[model samples]
Target: MERLQKVIAQAGIASRRKAEELIQQGSVKVNGKVVKELGTKVTRNDRIEVDGIQIEKEEPVYFMLYKPTGVISSVKDEKGRKAVTDFFPMVKERIFPIGRLDYDTSGLLLLTNDGEFANLLMHPRNEIEKVYIAKVKGIIDNEKVRKLQRGVILEDGKTAPAKVKVLGSDRKKETALVEITIHEGRNRQVRRMFEAVGCKVTKLKRERYAFLGLGALRPGDGRALTPHEVKQLRAFASATK
Candidate 1:
């Protein structure tokens, strides 16, 4: 037996937090009885239902979305702004972003209903590497790139040292494309890091995170991750931990 929320999440009913909300709102039932308690437990033999629809245990689903700019990373936006969830309207199973991608910054984002997998990917101890391609104003010198590699202080504090490399330069346009690989998921850390070096970032897109790559996925396109991919991600998390 396990907590009801865990069962709900494992069954792809919703994220653990969302399942808890459903329980609080009297939307979930166990053994044919409405259950509103947060800590209620259920076994495989127990019958679970939501909104009078029977819930069945399902294999966890994982997805990789090539998010476009301007979409919020949340499941729902309170201000009515477009959210990532709007892209997966047909997905019956509930899921949430494993981590986050800021609005106006787009790229690979993972969505999953497995709470334990999400926890592993999001934990700082896992140290999963995320790679990004950034377009910055003006040409950045090698010395400044070295500073990014060494680490720089942000308004909040010092940032972890990142792997920085100059991808190339558009000499006529006075802009440069740089690649940055970081393990820490600080809020807007990539943009802030470039800003700290007096570079204005015009566009930023994540290329990869851990063993997952964006590949040729176009903006706004998404696909469910294969079992092998999911297993690799879990193994990467464990190895990093």
Candidate 2:
């Protein structure tokens, strides 16, 4: 037997937290009986329903999306804005995003129905590294780059040291692209770090996360992760913890 929320999430209804909310709202049923208790136990043979629609367990699905700018990384939005899920119109299993990227920020984003794997990737204890390519508004100097490499104090406190290097320079344009690697998943961290150094971030694109790299995958395209890749990711997560 499994907790109702876990079963619901496994069945791809929603995230575990959101499944609890659905249970409280009296939208969930087990074996044709309405179940409002959050911790109720269920089994594979038991039938589940949400808002009167019966649900069936499906094979776990995973996808790596090269998210493009202007798309929100969420399952649904009240504002009616375009969301990442809209791109996968035929995906029946309810999947949730692994981490997050700002609405205007673009890069590699993983979507999957494996809640435990998602939690492992997002948990702070894992310390999985994420790399980014950022274009800032000003010509950053070597001193500022060194400061960023050593770590800087943000308004919230000191940030984890980041690996930063200037890729090159466009002196006439007054802009430079730099590569940054960080382990902490702070909100808008790369952008914030640049701001702390008095440079405005013009473009931020994630190039890698953990063992996954956004290799020739163009923007807005997605593909299933290989079994080896998934195994490697799980091993990395376990090793980090």
| Model 1 global lDDT (CA atoms, 0 to 1) | 0.89
**For model 2, the run of ten residues with the poorest summed lDDT:** 7-16
Residues 1-241, model 2: lDDT tens digits: 8898887776666768888999999999898889999879987888999999887776678889999999999998999988888778889887778888888789999998877568767878889999999998887999899889988888777888899989988878889999999988888888999999888899899999997998889999988899889889989988999
The TM-score values for the models, in the order shown, are: 0.80, 0.80
The global C-alpha lDDT for each of the candidates, from Candidate 1 onward, is 0.89, 0.86
lDDT of 1 by residue, 83-183 (tens): 88788988987778888999999999999777767877887888999999999997789889999999999988888889998999887888999999999
